[model samples]
Target: MNKKITIYSENPFYDKSLKTRHMKATIFKMVTLSSLLFSLGFLIFFLSDIVIKGLPAFQQTYIQVDVTYNEKTVKSTRKAVNKEYRRLVSRSWLRTIPQQVIDNPNLMNTKIKLWILADDQVDQYLKGHHHNLKPKYIQSVDNLVKNNATKLRFNIIFFTRGDSKIPEYAGIKSAVIGSILTLIVTMVVAFPIAVMTAIYLEEFAADNLWTQFIEININNLAAIPSILFGLLGLAVFINLFGLPRSSPLVGGLTLAIMTLPIIIISSRAALRSVPDNIRQAGYGLGLTKIQVVKDHVFPLAFPGVMTGSIIGLAQAMGETAPLIIIGMVAFIPDSPNSIMQAATVMPAQIFTWAGMPERAYVEKTAAGIMVLLTILISLNAMAIYLRKKFEVKW
Candidate 1:
C-alpha cells in the first residue's frame, strides 16, 4: 500500500497515443486543404477557357455589300450583291430576299448599300481562327478588311433567331424559350405536390409501417439515376397518357418526377428543424394541428421550402440525359408558343451544337455552355440569398 502507484497519465505510452492522434488529425487537415485548392484551380482554368472561346461568338463578321433589289434578285438571291462578293455573304441571308421584297414592295427596284452577314467561312477568316475558306475567299476577306468594307459587329442574330444549318444565322432564342416553358411546367407540377407530401410525412402521417415504407422509397428515389425518370416519363406520359413527344409538357412532367424526391427530402428536413416546443406551445394555445402547421410552423419553414424548391429546379434545368430520353432533343428551329409544341431546352440545344462538324459551331457550343452556366449560377445564388435572408436561429 505504501508503494507509489503509476497513473496512466504518467506513462510514456499515454503521451505517445495522444501525439499519434494529433499527428493524424494534422495530416488529414493538410490533405483536405490540398484537395480544396486543387478543385478551385481546376474550376478557374475551366471557366477561363470557356470565356476565351465564347467571347468570339458574340461578335459576328459583317461585309458591306451593294444590293440591287430587282425581279432577278428576288428570284436569284445570288444577284443581290456584286458577283465578286457573293461568295463571301451568307446564303441564309440571301434566301430571305424574296420575303423581304414581298414585305416592302416599294423597294422592288431600289438599289441600296448595306452591311450583310458574311458566310461562316469568311467569318472565321475575319476572326483569325482556323478557317476552311479557299485562297480566293481569304483574299476577298482581306481586301474587305483593308477597304473598311468588313467589320465585326455585335451578333444580334445569335440572340434573336433559332437553330439554323448556317452558323451565321443560328441562335438560342428557341432553346431559351423552351427552357423557360419547361421549367414553368416543372415548377407548376412539382412544387405543390412535393411541399404537401413533405408536410404530410413530417407532420400529419402516423409513424406506421406504411409511412416508414414510403419514407424509405422516397430516400431511394433521390439516389436513383435521372435517366430512369426519363424512361418512366416515356412509359407513363407518352405511351399511357398520349402526351405529345418532345413537348415542354412531357419534359416538365418528367423533370417534376425527378425533382420531387429532392424537394420533398429538403422540405422534410426544414420542417423537422423547427423545435418541438413550438408545436407544444401551439397545442397549449387551443390550436388544432392543421392551424399550428399552417399558421406557425409553415410560416417559419416557408423560406427553407422555397430555397429547396429553387435548388431542385436548378438541378432539373441542367439535366440532359432525362430530357434526351423523353425526346426533348429534337431539332427545334422555331420558338414554341405553346407548351404542347415540339421544343428543345438549352442543354439539349448545346448538345446538338457540340456534335456539328463545322468549325464555327465550336464557338457556338462554348457560348451556349457559358449561357447555361450563367443561368445555373444565378439560380444557385438566389437560393443561397434566400436561405441566408430568412434563416431562423431556433
Candidate 2:
C-alpha cells in the first residue's frame, strides 16, 4: 500500500498577516504626518500672533497742538499745551520744548500750530489698545482725527533711535549694533582655531592618551550649558583679566569658546567625508601630507566649516542667558562704535524691554525679535548658498 501525502506551501492565514503589516505601516505614516502638521500649525500661529502684535509699532500716532514758547512754557511744559489736551501729549515731547526754545531763540514767545508726538494713552487709544483716556480727551482725539490732525505716520524714530525709558523713543539701534559687533568678534576668534583643530584632529593627531583626552573634553565642552560659559567669562574675562564687564569683547570671546566646539565637530565631519583614497592618491603623487591637506582637503572642507560657523553665530546672536550673566543688561541708549565699549546685544535688549512697565515695549520687544529672526534667517540662507556652491560630492 502506497500513501501519497501533499504538503501545501501556502498558509490560509497569510493574507491576514500581509493586511496587518500594511495596516501598521499606514497608521505609522498617518501619525508622522499628523505630528508634522501639528508642529507646522503651531509655528504658523506663533508667527501670526507676533506679526499682529508688532505691526502697529512701525507706525505711530501724531497730534497737532498749539505750542506757546514763553518763559512759563519753558519752565513748565504742562501749562504749555492746552489744558484739555495736555494728557494727550507725550511728556518726552513736552520736555524738549524748553530745549527747542533754547535751540531757536527766535521762537521765544511764539505760538505756532505744530504736529507733535501723541501721549502713550492717546497712541494706545488710536491703536485700539486699552487706554484710560478721559471722555473729554477721547473727544479731543476724535476731533483731531476728523480734522486730520491726529493720524498714523511711519515712525522713523523707532528705527533711528536707541533704548530709551520712553517707549516711543526706545529703539533697537544699540542692540543691533552690539549684535553685529559681537558676531564679528566671535567669527574672527572662533573660525580659524576651530578649522585648525579639526584639521589636526582629523589628519595629524595620533591615537594617544593626550589626544584622546583632548577629543573627549572638546565633546564635553559642546554639551556644557551656555550659562556656564557666561560664568566663565564673568570669572576669567571680567574678574581676572579686568576686561570691560559689558563690552562686546568679553561677550564675543565667551561666544567664541561656546561656538568653537560646534565648529570643530562639524568641520571634522566635513573633513572625514572626503574619501581616504583621495588622501592616499595625493601621497602616491609624492605630495607631502601637509600639502595634501592644505591644497585639496581644506578647500573641500571650508564650505561645511563656514556653514557651521554661520549656524553657531546665529545661535550666539539669539543668546540672552550668557549676555545677561556678563552684565549686558545695562540700559544702552547710545550705539557703541567700538568693541571695547559697553554694549547690549538684541536678546538682552529684548529681555530688558519685556520686563518694562509700559505697554508700548511689548510691541518693541516683538519687533526686535522679528529683526533678530530676519538676521538669523539671512545667515542661514547664506550658509545654504555657500554649502551648495562649494560642497564637493566626490
Candidate 3:
C-alpha cells in the first residue's frame, strides 16, 4: 500500500473573493465620505450667502434732520425735512412728525435736531449696495455722514412691530406669535395620535394583508409631495369642513396632516429598534405583550420617538406651501390672539417679504431666513442631544 500524504492549501477562490470585497468596501467608503463633504460644502455656501444678505437688517441708517416744527410744517409734516432731503427720509417718519408735535407741544417752530431713519435708498447706499438714488440725495446723505448726523443705529422696530408696506415698519412679531399658536395646536393634535398609531402597528396589530397595505400606504404618504398636502387642506379643511380660512387652527390642522406620516414612520422605526430578545425576556418573566412593549420596549424607544417627533415638528414649523394654500398668507399685521383668528406664520411672512418690489425686503427676507435656520438648527441639536442621552448600544 502506498502512503498517501495530503497537503492543505489556501482556497484561491475564497482569497480572491476576500480581496475583491476589501477593494469594493474601500471604494464605497471613499464615495460616501466624498458625498458627505460635498453636501457640507454646499450647506456652508448657502448659510454664508444668507448671513451676508441678512446682517444689514439688524442696523438701520439714520439721518439727523434740523426740524422747524412750524404750524405749516406740522400741518404737512413733509416740510419738516429739507426739500432736497425729504425724499431721502422715510415717508413713515414724515407721516409721524405731525403726531409727534401733537403729543409733545413743547416745540413750536423750534430748531430741534432729530435723528430719523433715512430712506431705503440711503439705507442701501450706507450698506454699499447699489441703488437708484439721485446725485442730490447722495450728496445730502454724504453731507449728513460727514457732519456725524447720518449714522447706523440698532434696529428695535423690527422686533416690536408687525408687517408693514413700508419696510421700516415691517416686523416679525406677529408672525412669531402666529407660529407659536399654530405649532401648539399641531403638537397637541399630532403627538398622541402618532404615538398610539405606532404602538398599535408595532405591538398589537396582527400581521395580515391589511396591515401590510396600511404600512405601504404610510410609507408612500411619507414620500408624497408636501404641496399635495396643501391642496388636500384647501379641499378638505377649507371647502368641506368650512374652517375659518387663514386661521392658525386651519393652518395647524393642515400641517398636522402633513406631519402625521413623518411622526408615525419615525415612531414605528423607534419601536422596531427594540431587540426581539428583550421582548422574549419580558415574556420569560410572564409579562404580556402589552406590558412588555409599554414597560420594557417604550422606555428604551422614548428618546428616539421624542427625537423624531421634534424633527417632524421642526419641519412643520418651516412649511409655507400648505399655509399659503389655506390662505394663511393673508397680510396679517397684527398677531392672532387665538387659534381661531386669521394668522400668518414666520415662513409665510418670509415668503411674502421675498416677493416685494422693495430692496429693503431683500434684507428682511434674508433675516427671516436666518431666524428660521436658527430655529431649525436648535431643534436638530436638541434632537441629537436627546438621542445621545437615551440611545442604547446593543
What TM-score against the true fold does each predicted structure earn?
0.92, 0.91, 0.87
Candidate 3 lDDT by residue in tens digits, 1-394: 1222122124333443666899999999999999999999999999999999998998898888877888998888888877877898898888987788789898787877788888888898889986878998888888888888888889887888789998877889999999999999998999998888999999889999999998898889888888888899889988999989999998998888778889999999998999889999999999998899889998888989999999999999999988888898889888889999999999999999999998988998999898888999999999999988888887
Could you give candidate 2's per-residue lDDT for residues 1-394 as a string of tens digits? 1221122224454454666899999999999999999999999999989888888888898899898889998998898899878888888889998889879999998899988888877888899887778899899999888888987889888878889998787889988899889989999999899999999999999989999998999999999999999999999999999999899999999999999999999899889888888899999999999999999888877788888888888888888888899998899999999999999999999999999988888888888888888888898899889888987878
Candidate 2 has a TM-score of: 0.91
**Scored by Cα lDDT, where does model 1 land?**
0.93
Q: Which stretches of model 3 miss by more than 4 angstroms?
A: 1-36, 107-109, 276-296
Error (Å) of candidate 3 at residue 16 is 16
- Runs of candidate 2 exceeding 4 Å displacement: 1-14, 17-21
lDDT of each model, Cα atoms only?
A: 0.93, 0.89, 0.88
TM-score of 3: 0.87
Task: Kindly indicate the candidate among 1 and 3 with the higher lDDT.
Answer: 1
Clashes in candidate 1: how many? 0
Clashes of each: 0, 0, 0
Give the higher-lDDT candidate: 1 or 2. Answer: 1
**Candidate 3 residue pairs that clash:** none
| TM-score leader | 1
